[model samples]
Target chain A: MTKVIAGASMSLDGFIAGPDETGFEHLFRWLGAGDVEVPTANPGHTLRMSAVDAEYLRDQWDNTGAIVVGRRLFDLTGGWGGAHPIGRPVVVVTHEAPTGWEDTPFTFVTDGVTSAIERAKALAGDRWVGVNGGTMARQCLEAGLLDTIGVDLVPVVFGKGVPLFGELANAPVLLGAPEVVVGSGVTHLRYDVLR
Target chain B: MTKVIAGASMSLDGFIAGPDETGFEHLFRWLGAGDVEVPTANPGHTLRMSAVDAEYLRDQWDNTGAIVVGRRLFDLTGGWGGAHPIGRPVVVVTHEAPTGWEDTPFTFVTDGVTSAIERAKALAGDRWVGVNGGTMARQCLEAGLLDTIGVDLVPVVFGKGVPLFGELANAPVLLGAPEVVVGSGVTHLRYDVLR
Candidate 1:
């Protein structure tokens, strides 16, 4: 079954992106660092992975079959320059589809997040439908369509910024015990959304 | 050498406590559950610790020799009923020392965070000087006196509340890669403060 999974690298203070939709370079510095052996449970054993950034990107891209993003992110990134990064079917949840981009790679769903997610699920088939952008992910979470949340928590604090979970209308969602993977400079946490 | 260490359990959205200084039962539900083996790095290895709450209380109390807390927290908790839970010397950073509390186990430091930390260090000797409450912790972080930060990140998210790191006067403090320990319902993260 296809699951709706969302992942983002956020600061220790919970800001996924800085104010004014700023780039996440500061929060994601650990990912670009070279490979380093991170300690785990077994005192005699260590797990080796690629650089933090590369591992996260490779895992998400490999596991995802489609992507859903918000209109603001679509505009901010200029629609991924007419080509989606992961080469997946991209659904943009917006009030109005952009003009003169019919040949582009993005599918704009203006109706609502539900319609966008439906389209994404259709495209995803048996793989995961990933959500990007805080607004779109929050919408999926609020609509109870998101099944998993993976956070790459970097060890930096943005005193203020765009909070990953903000302005939700439902009661707090309960999450199963998280699976934590300690990396070079980022700790990866995956949680299953409880119904 | 005495290290100034700060620890707090915060919501996924970065709130250390709820609004109006509300109780942390919601954010801390994981602590009450018992006897769960948390998975770690090694495939065959699992960490068996006490219940989340018990482990946190024990580790903090055992490792700490003295504590520094904000005046508001000191007042809110009624000075921990004239004695701190750790049974160590407590320094309360306030503008003026509370009357009649001089005879109590708490010490009110009107000078500043530095002075409070100094007094805590004197009492702590070679052990850890624990910083409690967000305001006092932020002050220690801003002063470059905090040597480590341990955060027990709960899976719950409060839409809004007292943020863990708020109103810092200095630039973002970089932290070393954290040691991640996944527990029953909480993920404990400890990071070294990069000088």
Candidate 2:
């Protein structure tokens, strides 16, 4: 069975993005400092993720067969230059798909987050479906679609920005005991959703 | 030398307190689960903090010679019933000292955070001074008086409450690599403040 997992590098203040939303680079700086190659929207250079951080990042990608992301993230990164960074099938949850990307490799689900996850699960087959972007992950969590949550807590704190878990209409979700891994520049915490 | 160290148990959302400003119990629940005795504002039942959590809590108290807290926290807890919880001297920072408490064990410093810390350092002798409460810790961090910061990151998240670090007049303070200890219910992260 395909399991849905959500992962992101967040600041100590729980902000996945800075005020301008262009600060993921700072929040995920640890990934670049490592020795494993990480695919990014940027084409100029390749970032390295090493040691425990490398293992964690590689596991997240290797286990993931598909991804679900938000429309804003897609738009901000220019639809990953028409190709998802992970080279996996991506189901983007958006109210409206951007024009001219109809033929793109990414699948934009306009119905809702559940619909997007459904498409992702179908694409994932027996593998895991990973969800990114704060809003999409929150929606998956609220809908009880996420099986696991991986948070790479960075040391820095953004005074203000997009919070990871904002006002969710659903009740507080209980999480199982977390797997804690202290990396070079980030602490990786993985928790199973107790549904 | 008496170092000024700030410590607090904060939620994943960086909230030290809940909406009603009385949620430290939930954040610091692991302390009660451990085997060490924690002196709380309430003198009812004794809470034990043992095992790794107990060691951590005991070390914090053993190394602390004095404490610095905000007036609000002091007032809310009725000045720790005229005696500091750790049986050490406490410097309470506020605009004015509360009436009729001038003869209490806790010293109310109206000058400023630096003044309060100075008094705490004198009382601390060669031991470290701890700063508690959100406002006082922030002030110490902003004033470059905090030498270290220990945060026990709780798994729970409060939707809204007092944030650990809100707006600060100074630039972002850089923290050295943290010493991470994963406990039963909380992850203790201790970082050296790079001044």
Choose the strongest candidate by DockQ: 1
Candidate 1 ranges beyond 4 A from true positions? A21-23, A35-56, B35-57
lDDT of 2 by residue, B1-195 (tens): 789988889877678877776567678678777655766544764667657886777677899999999988888888777777677888899998777876666888899999999999999999999999878888888888988888998877565678887765663455677898888778899888776
TM-scores, all models, native as reference: 0.88, 0.91
For model 2, residues A14-103, the per-residue Cα lDDT tens digits are 788777665666787787786677665447556687778777777777888999999888888787777776778888888877778776
Candidate 2 ranges with C-alpha deviation above 4 Å: A36-45, A102-104, B22-25, B34-45
Looking at model 2, the pairs that clash are: A34-A50, A35-A50, A36-A49, B34-B48, B34-B49, B34-B50, B35-B49, B35-B50, B36-B49, B36-B50
Q: What are the chain A TM-scores for all the models, listed individually? A: 0.86, 0.90
Question: Could you tell me the TM-score of candidate 2?
Answer: 0.91
